[model samples]
Target chain A: MNYRIVTNNPSVKEVYKDIIFVNGTFLDVLINVRDLVHKGHELISHPLGSSIRTMYSPYRSIIVRNKTNEINKDHIEVIENSIYSYKNTMQRRKPDAVNSKDYAMLDLNLLKSALDEFKSIYDY
Target chain B: MKLELGRIYIKDIQFGNKTHVNNGTLIVNSQELIDKLKEDERVKDVKVDIARPGEKVRIIPVKDVIEPRVKIEGKGHGFAGVTSKTEQLGEGKVNVLYGAAVVTVGDIVGFQEGVIDMWGEGAKWTPFSKTCNLVVDITPIEGLQPHNHEAAVRIAGLKAAEYLGEAGRNVEPEEVLTYEIGTHTEEEAKYPDLPKVAYVEMLISQGLLHDGYIYGVNSQNILPTLLHPNEELDNAVISGNCVAACDKITTYQHQNNSVILDLYAQHGKTINFMGVILTPELTTLEGKFRTCDYTVKLCKMLGVDGVIISEEGYGNPDSDLLMICKRLEKENIKTVLITDECSGWDGMSQPLADTAKEAVAVVSTGNVSHVVTLPPADKVVGNAAAIATLAGGWEGSLEADGTIKCELNAVIGATSEIGYHNCTVNLY
Candidate 1:
């Protein structure tokens, strides 16, 4: 899928338009792109002029991090592992066969891990 | 402002020859109600039914629930602006048909209408399950849009409540409750030592099917404003939004607002109850900033020491709640927030769209996306199949049998943000 970031910061948008080598989930890319824009890097709106060009899942989750507090590589690995496990579990289930409500509860263990890092950081 | 409520407890409801209150029972002439609602050309037909507590009945796609009330004295009548003339309310001798409610149900207005189960496990989730409900199912004219259909159904419910409230006028009440609140200066002089607390209510005003009306005006079209708690208790504000049912503030909850009542209970003793501030949750970013800033400014202007902010819908409106809280805490004003969550069925998602450290003290009114299964009812009022398209429900939610499997969002008042019900969320 083609993922593009449209930002209010014109300088960031101008510099990031030509850059391409991206491989990540739509939510993952949005969070990283938003962080980049917040860092004062030059930015501009996408050519399509959409905040989100394309996304795999309609249910989008945006995780906002506190830039003042840095997270180590180990913490990133834990979160990534959790995401992978959650995705794998979801893929194994037949989404068309079950309703969204029922689908949400298919793998509570995986869901908990997927949200562990966010919950720890936010103190929820 | 001072108001007197004469409560006539209705132990049962029956369809009989006449519409009146007798021996703790409310008798209604269903045909009369149908004729009254049919007067509106926008509505094609009206069906009235009854669902009593502990009955094997299910009411789906419920829109609004209203308590019946009649103004016997004072300035204005019950539902002053809409059902009656636009007059001052809350300082009147009103008669209430306590333990009874006017519940509106019909075709899907939006993907947010809920279900009401009168018995079994589902009964514990919603307050309306305990009331003697006079369900009014209205069908709009052919080709009517959802927005217009919502308006027609809302008016029909209010009209039905006003009609039923009339039955209590001549009959003597079993109990009477009085409420009186003085002006700001009067309260300050009377309770100089008590902490002054105010209530800020946020209304959903996204547009067409999602909106709240105050005195017949859409709240989104106006700025943050002040209101006496009495005005709300007297039905000055009406809920017209089609937000997810669990969190939606129905018209009944507005009249018997739990927060206002509890605060009133502690008025002269624990705290000096200040007036209420009604704020709107707009859809646009600019509108949100404008409204949130104006709300905090009003709180500061009120010179309140503590405030309780209650949110209406979830998702985008969560930002407005935090924004208001951030500003209020900056002004050193103590605050407590009441809201429901959409933390997914597993309760693993974030409870809110935005978060602020200043929002330390909060009340969680259960999770809207929590999954539940309801047994089949012996009899179902309105279309049970309507659950499939509900916000908290999805395709195949209604089984071949009468059983229903859906999210709490499809249940009416399951997670009332006003603290009307006792449901809450606790981390395991």
Candidate 2:
């Protein structure tokens, strides 16, 4: 089963033209992937039926493959490190990329912090 | 001259859209009213308030009247814009242009109120009109004189010489005169076969040959020589304190302080003394006379028959240059000015050129011996040496390297041609 990812951000469109889903994992199938991620975007998911369960936990972490009930800190750190390295590379490639106003996918910590702040503002 | 007062009469007048009158009964002596009437082209004639009762009306030409007008143009702008997350939106933009017009007092132009209109996307509205007036009057002035050719040539020559002198070279008179009362024995001994006019012309031309009078050195250093010619003269038999006396003999047999005097004596000519040295090399200003005073002292010391100085690049030389010319005039020293590198401030060059021209005119009119200027270097078309040659009024190749390469043709071109016109191309 396969899914796709798309973003409306012009900066994202400029870099990541498309995304690909292979097996159970999603991969950014785009040229200049770093630039697309650095510009930012809203993350949305589409899943193949019965193959995976997608759940956004209270901690703002996106869960996939229900068989792994426990969250692995090392795996989360690897993803975070990869995102940070991609952003750094994008910055070096195009200094003006950061100045662009664009939506982008949020990592667990950033997503959690933003959701927390929103909840506090709403007194929820 | 007869006292002729100009007459004025209104040519035409128009009062709003009601009436266009060739002749009107609104009699008045006000120049302001006359100017306004003149502006109205519809008015063919205006009545002037004469002292006499019935014949108070007088007709005047509109062209003869003078008028003034003012026109202005201005613009202002206001703008706003917004965007929402629900949908994509394009930013808004705005721009405006406006101006004003003025009619001359007596111009007789059509009067109309100007209107401004504003209309655009996401913009506000405002409409308005501006009314302006024009004025006119009458003025009579004098005309100028016709151009003088010989005077122009003399001025050009004087300017050229002055430029060269300022650049630091010893220059000579543009013209020379000689009175020969020699014995027949001397003529027979020298060249009895030569024609009198020919010989005299040759001698005078050589003696009068005045070109390249630039002070190669600064004038201040040359001052000591001027003040003490006798002490500086060594084995120079014909050396004299007076420049004129030294001009009688040719050949300097000495190498003392009076090198300039000896050079003049040997050459039977005058040497231009620049009075003070001023160059990038001498960083200090202590030894230099004020530029103006130095010019005057140089003219006096060198027994300047004719003096030329540039008014370009230098500041107000009027008082100093004029005073020197006056002083020289009293002692019968001719003075003229050349201008280059005009100072845009005060229109100094044009005025100085005018004054130099006037000076030449006065001397020529008085039948006094005048100083002529040399043709200037064609800076655009020639090398440095060629330019210097032109500046010095000398015939030679003045190369960019500052070398004065003389040819036989150049030497023979002018028999009395002196080497002082030679340009030194300082390679360093």
Candidate 3:
């Protein structure tokens, strides 16, 4: 499926581009991003015009876990979206992470819709 | 001829020389000689003269009777006079008439005259010359013996219990749980901050819960999306999913247990069906639904006594109903499935009733218990009562009550009196 990254930030565009190219898709890139976010990683950025520059540090420090886990691909996508949403909400409220919500609400609707779509295609 | 008690007198005494006795003379009275020697030849021309108290009479030839050589027959025969006019001697001993030498206990002796008195004089009597032996014969009488199925069931149950514990837990049995998910309807109502809520009630009334645990899964809140970011949500989803999966597995295990019990109970086991039913609402997506054969086979495998299916509000028959009947018949399982529409009556459809009749007929012919059609939901109790009446007797009358009390009464009464030896109403 074709994926696109939409943001007004010129500096963050380079970071999103690098992730998309390296992971081949927004979903694949989000998996690494979510793990970093869960482990207390922070994104540093500066505003350019009306947008802010966002940087994604490489996940060189995150341990490589067992590769044979059977968690559904769709579940991974939801966790990724929740991570992004959490970071975005924190950035919108404050320039620095002085206070943060303990956990972000996962978008169940999006995940369910995606699942229903997948089921339709597979006819399962 | 008779002799004194101390004197030795021999008549018809065969020596090793094999000389036959001929004419002989006795020193006893003529009447005594005639009475002692019933054989005509023994006394035909023999003269018996009474001698002095213990004197012995000399055997002098009457005319030159060859000195009356003392030749005697080896065996002796005499007619013991009849007593009650009945042929007492020949009553059953028909083979005793053969002249076989047989020694018998008796007090009288023909050799002694005064030792044993003669009751009558000149009374003619015939004696059997050849020895006769008495023999008794016997013979035995044959018929049908019936077998006890209850005893068989008990023995099987005990043996099964030894090899297999109560629920066949030693080893995994086969899956007996067959279930059908009803067609999903539109959301009845939605909760304000919650994802659209749907009411999903399984249509499992068609199958039995005989020996298995049934788990209903409702993962309304633990959607996959909610599993992310929140540990609590994730935990809930994991727990619910585990329960759902485990319940399915356990149901299958118990289904197998029932089959083992049934094998012990009925001697045969088979799979009949395990599939879904097609309803009118599902017609648009007929191809989307699986067949009802699986459910039928599962029911048969588990030895389900009956199945109850809730009919859709519309008049269309549930496909599973017919499938259950046919498959149960094929596997020799007694089945009774009910539809919701027929709920007002005791789960009985003319078709279902007919099928039950046919199944019962087939099983009965093979010495197996017959199957009875359980009326649909509406007729369950009433039909049971009707069945009770037909069975007759006090037990049947009590069973007509259609209550737990009735079940107990019927069991106790039937088993005690008529020896009913199949599954009873109280067993379930």
Candidate 4:
């Protein structure tokens, strides 16, 4: 359960000490996760974790295996496929919601669930 | 386990001096119910309103819808673990407010929350439109976290139902339906000739507003497990999911799961109903493989001839559904998947995130992305403008004439994966 949170939601910055905060859309967060996966960090949680409709929410937070090593093919496949599906589903529409904070909180809370398990496993 | 549900059909609802039921009408003391919900400090204010079958009222930003039931003979009341102490359900007599629903309406937490119109074209889509709805509009105290906001609305709906359910405790039901199922061994012995069929109910347990509850424990914390069908009907599993409005399994849906009921109907007649396997759709790929594999193993151990696997919400979970289906087919085990599609507005997009050659027998509840237009209602509850930000809705979805143009995803239960909706796909 070793993981690191990658998010654009400023809400998580105060909570998690380590996070790759990318100031971008939901797609931007997934792309950031992809960049991590390419650099040897495997994804611990699905990039599509909190939602299946990737383009629907304005914010997204992903958890990735923090330890870097040889490339994990499975992680790459998942992230690439996720990015493709996301781009396909969204049809180039920008991330949106009635209120940005509402979507941010939704993403933050879901990330917290995986963080709970990660904390227990990492024993921090 | 044997449970008898006494149904008292409610014909109407009215605000009265005291909360009670008379004849077929459900009378509520608004202040009393509001007071009960406000006891939770997270909830700042509560408003109780009535919307009947053909009213010109529209309830927007709807959260959870719960059925009101009073346990006259059960060990514990319904909504165990949350509204009441942890207790075993599914083995007692409970009185139900058959045609009434407690609908919670409030701030839209995300791209979730939906609309429930009482009449016109909009009414045809949501099953809640047919019930005598006791709309509970809750406003959380300012500065409440989004997670707590969801909880406040969720608990208020459950509490309102609990308080209203008390009125039915004394009223004699019009019909008493009994659901009795013995142990798998006992049933197998008696109905050895029938095809052994079991139900695999895949619940959303990703995270945050994306999880279901088993006796109030987050589904995210549990592995795939087995449950007597009665446990679901009697409130062993509950919905805290705030995903897509069209397909998310509401707490009400768990209480009146159509798949469980349909399986029970054919039990011993067409098939020997073994039991239900509750599988959690997790967020990790590893978790998905583990749950999917473990689920099929349970079905194999039961020696089930066939299984009806129903999914909650779409997308990543679609992969989980197919993984289990693929493995079951590999074992020569029969599986019929029940799900909704996310096909584009043109109905030309791929039906699911993943598919298997073994997924031959699949029942489509409806397409979540299908577009629909709902004419405005005379009276609107909650916020009408909330639809613009909903998953299936856009910034200009709410028009000048109060008309709304959006996908079926914004309409609650329009595409229920559990088969409790009005959606159908006719073969061309």
CAPRI accuracy category, model 4: acceptable
Query: What lDDT score goes with residue B318 in model 2?
Result: 26
Alpha-carbon deviation at B226 in model 2, angstroms: 4.7
lDDT of 3 by residue, B1-428 (tens): 11001111222222222222122111112233223233322112222222111121111100000001110111111111110111111111101101111111110111100010011110000011111111101010111110121112112211211111111112121222211111112111221222211111112111111011111222221111111111110011111000011011111111122222222222112221221122111110121122245444444443344432322111112232344456645765544332211111121222111122333321110110111221122112101232322222223222333321111111111111111112222111
Instruction: Compute each candidate's TM-score over C-alphas.
Output: 0.79, 0.17, 0.16, 0.93
Q: At residue B391, give the lDDT of candidate 4.
A: 28
lDDT at B249 for candidate 1?
A: 90
The docking category that best describes candidate 2 is incorrect
lDDT of 4 by residue, B1-428 (tens): 99999999999999999889988999999998988898999988888788999999988888889999999996777588889898888899999999999998877464555788899888889999999999999989999877788778887888888899999999999999999999988998889899999999999887767778898888888878899999899878877876668888888999999999999999989999999999999877777888999999999999999999999887678778989999999999999999987777777777676667899999999877777788878888887666555423345666788677777777889989999978976555
- Tell me, by lDDT, which candidate is best: 4
List-wise, what DockQ does each model earn? 0.04, 0.00, 0.00, 0.41
How does residue A33 of candidate 3 score in lDDT? 38
In model 3, the Cα lDDT at residue B45 comes to 24
lDDT tens string, model 1, B284-318? 44556778899888888888999999998765577
Candidate 1 clashes between residue pairs 3 or more apart in a chain or in different chains? A10-A43, A11-A42, A11-A43, A12-A42, A12-A43, A12-A44, A13-A43, A13-A44, A14-A43, A14-A44
Between candidates 3 and 4, which one is better according to TM-score? 4
Q: Please report the candidate that would top TM-score against the real structure.
A: 4
Residue-wise lDDT of candidate 1 within A1-124, one digit each (tens)?
1223322222333334523322443335444544443443322211110000011122222222334334344224323433443342232122222232222221121122223422333344
lDDT of 2 by residue, B60-166 (tens): 11111101100011111010010001211111111101111111111111110011111121001110111111112222121211112111211222222122112
Error of 3 at B200 (Å): 24
Each candidate: RMSD to true structure? 9.6, 39.6, 44.9, 2.5
Model 1, C-alpha of B263: deviation from truth (Å): 0.7
